[model samples]
Target chain A: MITPELLLQELQTAFSKHKYGAEPGELYAPIGYIMSLGGKRFRPLLTLLSASIYTDEWQSALRPAMAVEVFHNFTLMHDDIMDNAPLRRGEPTVHEKWNANTAILSGDVMLIRAYDLLLGIRPELMGKVLARFNQTAAEVCEGQQLDMNFEKRWDVTEAEYLNMIRLKTSVLLGFALELGGLLTGADEASLQLLYAAGENMGMGFQLKDDLLDVFGDPAKFGKQVGGDIISNKKTFLLIEALSRAEGTYRTDLEYWINAADFDKNEKVQAVTKIYEALDIRTFTEQKIREYFEKGLNALEGLPAPDGRKIPLWQFVHQLVERDK
Target chain B: MITPELLLQELQTAFSKHKYGAEPGELYAPIGYIMSLGGKRFRPLLTLLSASIYTDEWQSALRPAMAVEVFHNFTLMHDDIMDNAPLRRGEPTVHEKWNANTAILSGDVMLIRAYDLLLGIRPELMGKVLARFNQTAAEVCEGQQLDMNFEKRWDVTEAEYLNMIRLKTSVLLGFALELGGLLTGADEASLQLLYAAGENMGMGFQLKDDLLDVFGDPAKFGKQVGGDIISNKKTFLLIEALSRAEGTYRTDLEYWINAADFDKNEKVQAVTKIYEALDIRTFTEQKIREYFEKGLNALEGLPAPDGRKIPLWQFVHQLVERDK
Candidate 1:
């Protein structure tokens, strides 16, 4: 009965009511701004949905759920600086809008604020909650480090790349779900299942991001497709293409990747063509299915009856099935 | 029976044994690198010394003591990027050695690792400990932001400068001492005293740093004098001098400050003469003494007998009385 729409409304209310800090507007304003920018609130949504499995008062999980969102935006705000990104959600990045120093300092505070929010749960849960969160948080940093390391090298294996994404993007999602369940006082077995499902689902979600960047419909995708291709970002599709491509395919892919000057559209077209020849899309789809099935299977193991879990199921399914 | 030298040796051993992270060398090596760069270890030394006042097994507080050290270094790593400083302790900074992104990410993990180290304390203490640490961490970030805000303004007041340094530099030192006492099961009233004492001590320590930058001898100071004056950095002295100077004094000070081109020694000497005319050094020394006395007075309130606290008292006096 706890729908994603209801979760979204409660999250917006919580975020607005929350005051990050009062001093030095430069440090706290960006946190409110980024949280307001509102990128689907997927992690928090997942948290509330998971919390619903154990209690009807899923709304109680809102603050910790917001912690996941705050942590996510913290990474994005900092990552934008690392990637030298100009726009996020079609707005100037925190660094671009303010300055890199503001972004860095502000982002640092947001990370702490996330921990502050995490502290809102029951006292008995503090030890477990903090330990798990610390682990996930460190892994996210490690994941980002690996992604940065992969930037200069073309020899990055798929395993290394997957581990990077798993650590960077996926673990938090897992933590989000696990946190909700833990807060709701779900048994250990159920919490484990929830974490596994959320983590695998996160991998699926990221890979879907990779696919949609190339193959998603322009009208539906909202953003331009082939952005990953144009940038030669080391996404799942690109990694797969690099691994499978040989001779002519390899030559064309490498040429565009290294091209100092070329039309962006042409690079996209050429790379998409090379990817097509390598059946990278199908390979990506299979990987996506594999992850989704793994996640769904874990979710199925939960004791909550199918009737009670419909909304959460549909929410995750929408992520998997969407083209955008 | 506890000695400062014994504390330093234990701290160094703890730092050497600590493993920040593994796998991605780029992400974690800088943690080891910056920590190894080793400033005076003042904060950790304070923590362990504070612990000694409460328990003979002060060595048990080593992990949390290192937590203070780690948190301090985390700030340095990120602040180096914000300040765009190239050197930390006369060696290249983390960002200079590994780049800004690495510094940012590694600094983040260091912050979390600080919390992880805090977890080494008892479970029952987690809530109070995390809440206090969170407040201190956020305040530190706020202080850095204010420091950054001061960069462009000549209107910065002495009070504003003190608050900034207090937030930026003092609170963590306070927390470091307070944390050691908390870990060793100090009573509520005593813990409060330790925090106030350490915080004020930190203020004195920083004020001394500002004073030493201008007045300390080059042979003993180990770094150049008047570096703050040369940069027109809005430290306590500059703020005071700017406020107090009038007529001919103001005119002469403005000449050195605004002169786009001048010999470094000429600038230093001109600034020093202006400061001498304004009696700035005495004002700075008086302020430093005020803070040191405030701290020492609080330390006096602790139940520990005078003999048992000799090491702690001498350690503080050494900081107060040092030429450098």
Candidate 2:
């Protein structure tokens, strides 16, 4: 089987081969712009690697793998509009670069294009694939809505937050792996295991993101170390701390959260101190480890041989070990 | 084969059978809301009627036919946001009823649901149907973009306007007919003919809408007659008048277009008089006739017996004859 590195190169070539640009420059420009402003291409790579475990014909999964990536960007484009976010990947968002209407319309086209990308997969698989995609797409939206709904409330629970992330962030990752398996005709049990693996890994990845936001070296993280704390963004650490904080810890968190004016660093420092007092770091790390272990076990449970599973195994290690 | 009237009832029943309501009512309530604020179920009716042309198995097309209706409402929901229109079907628009973010997210789900509706069709037909739906959906976006682009320019030509309307309003109608034929395993030629017939009829329908807005009786039209004139909206008559006017006629047309303030009735009267002077009504009627006849011709050329085609023929007459 081709290594993950080589499969990624092929994925790049596949992406370049499919142009998002078309007439009515306004509608298509942002699609091309966002696709060009690349991320890790993490989801598609996972898809290809997941397929690599089953067959050497994993190259055919590249285009369908892109469906996940395109759909990911589509959600981001709309989510940015909802969040009224100014920057994405350290640059202006589609809504900011153009306008909300442009972002909304362009994001819409990106979604339709995602469906277009799925067309050439095995015809028999198309119906099931489409059904899964539709369900995931709806869940993502529901997740966003729940996330938004949480914003207006002060009592968001850890369970609620985790489920939100699973729906909003993790399900697509799960779908990515499931799609690859589906395309390769992986057995029912295997597909389920693959999806569970990705979903668990995704949970670990999101919690890692939470940990990095408050704890990682800013230079390596490439973002403010305690930005979420400063913004009082409800994250795993915050939720855990909120759930566990007692007496002064609770008072300080609420104080900073409700403060009308305070130094950004001071608020972040205070929040960090409270999280430490609450053992939030250890708590979050333990949760992250649990998920990562569950993910590893799912991968182990796959019917593929240890040799065939080695690449995916390595990729998951790399995923969980990322500092930023 | 079932009659169009019965097909419509079946379509309504099918629509009710599939609830848009789900958890995270925030993301779904708008879907149910918009679908419930119903209008003429014209597109899906054409789908079923077109299928009736081919076989008695047209009843099998009901669920798939709902796809076009769902897709049509999806466009309207998003377009309502982009146009900043406060009302749809005489009710508050989704964005107005909830919020823009709700509208955007709910609209996204609606589009995905449309894909879900298409999934249970013949497995072989799923791909072609999806491809066509994707293409049509993109054209609708492009057309809306062009329409928005025209908003900033006075130089938009009659041809540009026609093409834009064809993309925006006509193709989906064409797709509706084509989708029904496709679901019935209609031959390639019949599919093409069905699409073209629907496309031409769509053009006529849009033109007739343009004509009715300015000329139809207010009570009958269920909207303010001359509302388009009041807004200076670019339509068949206006585009034709803009292209054909010369000398004093040009001055009057330009004056009305540029006027910052004018009495609504007076402006409507003046524009109507100018249209009469320039023969814009006759001009628009001629264009409408051309399209409707082309649609009729396409229908007549279909390889179906005349008796079997009569329901579709009668339906087209009803569509063209609508005063509103």
- Give lDDT per model, in order: 0.88, 0.90
Model 1 lDDT tens row, A93-198? 9999999999999999999999998776777888888888899999999999889889998888889888999999999999998988998898999899999999
TM-score of candidate 1 versus the correct structure, residues matched by position: 0.97
Evaluate model 1 with DockQ and give the value: 0.78
Per-residue alpha-carbon lDDT of model 2 for B1-324, expressed as tens digits?
Answer: 456788888888878777875889899999999999988899999999988888887878877788889989999999999999999989999999999999999999999988888878888888888889999999999999899889888889988999999999999999999988899888999999999999999999999999999889887898889989999898888888888899998998899899999999999999999999988898888989999999999999999899989889989988877777
What is the per-residue lDDT of model 2 for residues A1-324, given as tens digits with 9 covering 90 to 100?
567778788888888778875899999999988888889898999999899888888878888899999999999999999999999999999999999989999999999999999988777999899999899899889899999998887889998999999999999989998888999999999999999998999999999999999999888999888989887788989888888888988888899999988999999888999988888889889999999999889989999889988787888889988998
Model 2: DockQ score = 0.91
The per-residue C-alpha lDDT of model 2 at residue B182 equals 91
Alpha-carbon shift of residue B255 in model 2 (angstroms):
2.2
Where does candidate 1 chain B have its weakest 10-residue lDDT segment?
A: B118-127
Model 1 regions more than 4 Å off: none
Query: What TM-score, over all chains together, does every model reach?
Result: 0.97, 0.99
Best by lDDT: 2
